[model samples]
Target: MNLKGKNVLVTGSEGFIGSHLTEKLVEIGAKVTALVQYNSFNSWGWIDTFDKNIKENINIVTGDVREYDSVKRIVKGQDVVFHLAALIAIPYSYLSPMAYVKTNVQGTTNVLEACREYDVEKIIHTSTSETYGTALYVPIDEKHPLQGQSPYSASKIAADKMAESYYRSFNLPIATIRPFNTYGPRQSARAVIPTIISQVLAGKREIKLGSLSPTRDFNYVKDTAEAFIKIAESDKTIGEVINAGSNSEISIGDLAHKIIRIIGEDVKIICDKERIRPEKSEVNRLWADNTKIKQLTEWTPKYSLEEGLTETVDWIKNNMEYFKTDIYNV
Candidate 1:
């Protein structure tokens, strides 16, 4: 599973975590085919932000994962595949659940089937902590029961199960990497960390947020990217669902306060009604039991929460133009 000269296809290379993963793969001498979600603008999103040398190492393909032909075509001749393309906005999923099913579920099926057809070396299916919902127990393990509290989480749950079935039935060299809340540079404003960072950077007196009591285990983007590489390089990870987390967590209110302290901003926290999820659908807590990934691979988080958040705040402050600080995104 050495990636020194292997061809790796990253399905959502234009995204936040995927962009970081692509850079990490290229650093280790992997030939990367970056599949960005095709758009009329012809933009590569965050991938475009990478340095010239890194961009040169990548072969960019504009394609839609929902289209089997496009997915199949890009997946060809690739030694490894990292499937990450999907509609990831939770609130938007509530409004358009069918879009989630079409992209997350059907798109994953297409990738799995294509991998089986091509006999690829390995395929790492990207997953989320949302699939585990509000964690039935603290430091939730992979065995924790999945409860779909939101449409987005439900879609991911279905996608995870589909990946499992593929391994059991076709015996595909597929492993699922479920990352917790990953935050860093180039992160879209839809995520909570970015939301707070952008507002604080904008010098807003009142920071608008949803429910403040929900807890989340946030992993740094760089750490999460390394975990993907580590998992893919280990034969023990095949057909296994591995977690990428710090095995630590913070309540949303506490996280916000920490960020405020880092940013040195005196902003009042305001509970925005429009920003909140439905009462029954909110994920109340999440903490990762990263024991499985530890047992399977040489992967562990290298960044502390404060260190990661400080870096994230600095990045957001410098790139304030990318965020709509006044708008509540989805």
Candidate 2:
């Protein structure tokens, strides 16, 4: 499945990881149709920030994945479809559970059906590590039992199941890339790494944060993007749910401190009650067992935490205006 000159549709191309993946797809010479969520402002989000050459290579479409007609229209004539569109904020998901269900679950179904209808050569479905809540054992693998602790994770679980059913029932060429906590440039403040970076770069010494004990397996955004490409290129990945992670674990507290150290900032960590998840909803641990992806595809994390954090600090330092350091970005 060489993507070179192939018709590829990247839904949610305006988003953080989506934007990066879109860039990588373009780099690999894929004929990309980037689907940005239609808005009144006609904004392309991160795609607008791309250089002229990158933007020129893309066929940008304004559409919503939750709308079947919109997805169908965009999914048409595409050889490969990468479905990344979804409502990803955990706190926001708690406030509006139905929105998560509609956007994440229903939106994914729309992608599967459209891909099946279009006879797309391959369909790469985006997934999150949150689906394996509070990992029951170390180095969680694909076989780990899923526990949806948050509405956001539950929605993703439903979406993953939908993709699975499409693979089994419809025999659709679908693969799920379940990435861990991916962080890098263009990431919104809703994520912990961005929240810490945005505040520190905003000259805030007292960092307001949520529960810090929960450990996560963080992978660089670029690495995660490459994982998608690797999975898409491998025939063995069809109907597989593979984990893309660094095979390393770091607590939220440690991650924050690492970022602060990278920025050479003297910061105080404050556990802001408003930012904390409910006791029962917090996922206490996650460590990826990336053996499947490594064995199945030529994918390995290219950036270490320190290296990735340094790059993120540099990016957020210059792009501080995009974040509101004073507000808890739910």
Candidate 3:
């Protein structure tokens, strides 16, 4: 499955990880069509930040993934489909669970159906660590029982199952790339890493956060993007669910302090009640067993947590204008 000359369609190409993956696909010489959610602003999200030369090489299409005709139209003639579009904010899901179902579940069904109709060579479906809510065991593996502690995670769980069913029922060439907390440039302020970095860069000595006890296995966005490519290129990955992660865990409190140290800031952490999730809804821990991805494809996390955080801090510092540090995003 050589991808260099193949046609690739990346849904959610305007977003954080999707933008990175789309750029990587372009660098690999793939004919790329990026599907960005349509808006009145005509904004391509982070794709709008690309240089002229890079943007020139891409065919950007505006359409909502929830629309079947829109998805089918963009999916035509594509050799590979990377389905990354979804409503991913956890808190917002609590406020609007049906939105999650509509976008995540039904939207993913749209991708799978369109790809099946188009007979795309391969489809890489994105899954999240949140689906494996508070780990029942250490270094969570693909075999771990899924616990949907939040509406966002529940929706993702349904999406993953939808992809699985497509593979089984329709023989769709699909693989699920489940990534643990991916963080880096262009990540929204709603995410923890950006939230912490944004406030500290805004000269806040006191950083407000949610639960500090929850542990997570964080992967840099670049590594996660590479995982998608590797999976797409691997013949062994079809009908598989592979985990992309650093395979190391860090508590939220420790992670915050590590970021503060990198920024050379003397910061005090405060527990914001408003930021906390309902007790049962909170995923207390997440650690990834990345053995499957490493075995099935040529992929490994290239950035250590400290190195990734340093780069993220640098990005947030320069892009501080994009963040509203005075308000809790969500």
lDDT scores for all predictions?
A: 0.92, 0.94, 0.94
User: Against the true structure, candidate 2 has what lDDT?
Assistant: 0.94
- Output the lDDT of residue 41, model 2: 94
lDDT tens digits, residue span 1-330, model 2:
899999999998999999999999999999999999999998999999999999999999998989999999999999999999999999999899999999999999998999999899999999999999999998999999999999999999999999999999999999999999999999999999999988888888799999999999999999999999999999999999999998989999999998888888899999999999999999999999999999999799999999999888899888888999888889
Report the C-alpha lDDT of model 1 over 187-249, residue by residue, as the tens digit: 989999999999988989999999999999999999999999999999999989988889998
Query: What are the per-model numbers of colliding residue pairs?
Result: 0, 0, 0
Per-residue lDDT tens digits of candidate 3, residues 1-330?
A: 889989999998999999999999999999999999999999999999998888999999999989999998999999999999999999999999999999999999999999999899999999999999999998999999999999999999999999999999999999999999999999999999999999999999899999899999999999999999999999999999999988899999999999998999898999999999999999998999999998999699999999999999999989899999889888
The parts of candidate 3 lying over 4 Å away from their true place are none
* lDDT of model 2 at position 173: 94
TM accuracy, model 3:
0.99
Residue pairs of candidate 1 with colliding backbone atoms: none
